[model samples]
Target: MNSNLTVMKSFFLLGFPGLSPKYYRPVSALLFFFYLAIAVGNIFILTFVVCEKSLQKPTYLLFCHLALNDLTFGTLTLPKIISKYWFGDGFISFHGCFTQMFVVHYLGSVTSFMLLAMALDRFIAICFPLRYPVLVTNNTITVLCGFAWFIPLPLMLTIVLHTLTLPFCKSNVIAQCYCDHISITSQACGENINIVLVTALCIAMLCLLVPLAFILFSYIFICVVILKMSNATGRMRTFSTCTSQIFITCLFYLPRCFVYVSNTVGFSFSLDVRILIVLLYSLLPAAVNPIIYCFRTQYIKQHLIKKIKTSRFGIQLNLSFL
Candidate 1:
């Protein structure tokens, strides 16, 4: 490993094996639609949350932010992933690799932190109904959302800076479609023990344990509170609103817990399994969030229907004028 050697060219990615060149066109077509679905769904969620005035509560405000984060999270990887498959080239420059790494990590960690904030909001709303308005105001959620985005900036900077310092004179074939930190760092010419350790610790704290603790604690308390209610109707309503969030919390955290805990300890599953698990964490939540909220909260569904009808009516009016 020459200390003076610097990166000369970009690395090409050979995506996880299983499928063959014979299936590339078909698989790439499917991937394009899937990516489009995720992008459109997340964008709709964010746009609806912002445009709807009735959804001005703290919970929904945080939800809007979550939707935005989800869109960014998907965007950070999916565009490049689609390109790789469509163009039959997964190669990315060193700078492109690092940029994707930072964006993905930054968006992902911020989303996790936002979930934590949402959990706290739920806890406060359920436990202290009388003081909910005063306690969890718009300003409060705004501040928390800002904090969530900003909290991980320094850590991400550290990761990026450390990543760039390492020489990449060795192999550059990234095993994954995007510039995954693990795959990229695995190719570094220098010893990545410290960086890997630091990253492991951050993943544990930021991605896995903290969010897990929050979800567990909040749900436990909420369950106890809900169970004590004798009115079946009241219980049903309460459960409906909360069940979606709980489902999302579980979906987001479980695979993350597995990956973070296992990867850090040097026990990793196959690349296919790992990518599938991460994809589950990424795509499922975005897909289900709107459905869950719509079914659980009638207000959200009504709002959506109303918006659609209004748009259709406007279209009809324009057609008549034409």
Candidate 2:
């Protein structure tokens, strides 16, 4: 309903750099398949997490948040990209643009924060095993998750209001698939974009990177603690507890580090490369979070299989009743 009414002029999307239409089509075809994979994969992850009760621990609870954020991240960008390429309409309304900008960044920052929360969760479990139950209880995890979602609201509003205050006289083309802070700010008439830049950087650094650094330090401490243990079983247990977090933290931060550093300093990357990075960074986390969270834990896997078998039995029972 929202996308149909195009009030703006022609959209200006950043096309594939260094490639003509001849090359773009094939590339797009490839990307479309990846996009579909992202959607299906994230949906499966979310569903499995919800269906399997054994995944109700603090770790997988945080992972559900991760999966939810990843779903939003991919949904915000990919479908529009596919539609624009195939259907010849790339325009987005002012409100739609704002919605996209606000939501994507909000969820993105939240997921980053959630990962840090997860790392802390792991830290407590591994570093102070005796205190973990008391420290990271259900109530504590709930409160942390609540703060993770709410703390970034003000920052998101700052960006949103700044974009809305600017006058968009006639220009409506966005260089990227979805409306981001950079593209939206480009259209602002009198708003001091430097303010937006500063605010964005502050939020990004404070929210995304600070937690990431904490996670890194926590991991280092965890490693040191693991090594100090005389027993090999103790060391292996500690490391195993953190394996999922380590994988997830790397997947979440690496691309973000690249994009943030490159964009903040105005280091230009090829459009094709940018697109590729965006696609991978957005989708890979979604694809991996579920697999790592589910497969890494024995309880979850067994519960999942049990549930599937029960569902199959129920289906046969229902047919017999019919």
Candidate 3:
């Protein structure tokens, strides 16, 4: 700690530097819409899974976990940015900012692990159907999902704690929509910046790459099993079940990897462009995940349709009596 370091109470968030102040209302409105969509879509999936007894299997349980994680992530990041644009208030307390950083990274790590769990479930079901029931019990899935949520806490906390020890004598204005590890740590004034950054980067890579490698290998094995199936209809049916997860996995991982790789390689984009890329990958997948599940997964689609029709029939029956 330096003697000249100044203690600050709060930090300001500068969102989309290139955008005009006049556009703030529209941007806020748009963000609010997205937040609403993310909430409703993921909540619907969770509600459907919880209420339907037939959906209590390992795959749907994993879907519920992903849905819950997306809902939490969207809630964590979107509201403050929306308020900043809508009300011209961007000040977040010093401790609050670090807390946000911890939760954001924590949820991201949990999601990566959850996706790996999903991949593993699919791999077992497809690659070794006969053994799946014995291997992937409800208790087994519960423990896997439990570890996904629990295992990342210490790593994320370590990064946040390390960043906290650095003295931020520079500007308190964060150059992005929200507080994140890189943006927050960049404000520190010291020679220890590189060490902190490298540590954070290594932890990030570990959290991201390890599960991604497993997911890729699992899918490869799954593909091999699918190809070996002699019947064309059976092959198509087996592959279709995994398509929704595949779409979501690609959507979540590919853009994120591109963003990280580009940053590491010094591929420069304008500040606003980089922020937009982050928002695209972080928020878009959450909003669209349930839609993909509903439209792509046959059982969920049928169940949703049946529920809608039953509600409509009940409403019509009440109207006739009235």
Top lDDT: which candidate number?
Answer: 3
Q: Candidate 3: what lDDT? A: 0.92
Over 1-322, each residue of candidate 1 has an lDDT whose tens digit, in order, gives: 4453354468777665666778777767876777777678777777787787778888888878888877777777776666777777787877888888888777778878888887888788777779988999999999999998998788887787777777767687877766767777778765764766577457637664676688789879988888999999998787676766776777777777777679789997887777667766766776667666666667788888898899999999999999
Q: Which digits, one per residue and each the tens of the lDDT, describe model 3 over residues 117-172?
A: 99999999998889999999889999999999999999999999888778888899
Model 1 TM-score on a 0 to 1 scale: 0.88
Model 3 RMSD to the real structure? 1.3
Q: 1-322, model 2: which lDDT tens digit per residue?
A: 2232244434455544455666555766765886676677667767876776656677777777777777777777776766656664567666877888898788878987898899899889888889998898767887899888998889898878865655565467676667778777776554455776777768767878788888889889888989999999878876887787788888888987888789989998776688668767766777677677667766667777887899999999999999
lDDT of 2 at 13: 59
Model 3 scores worst on lDDT over the 10 consecutive residues at 1-10
Show the lowest summed lDDT stretch of 10 residues, model 1: 1-10
Deviating ranges (above 4 Å) for candidate 2 = 1-11, 15-32, 169-171, 189-191, 261-267, 305-322
State the lDDT at 209 in candidate 2: 73
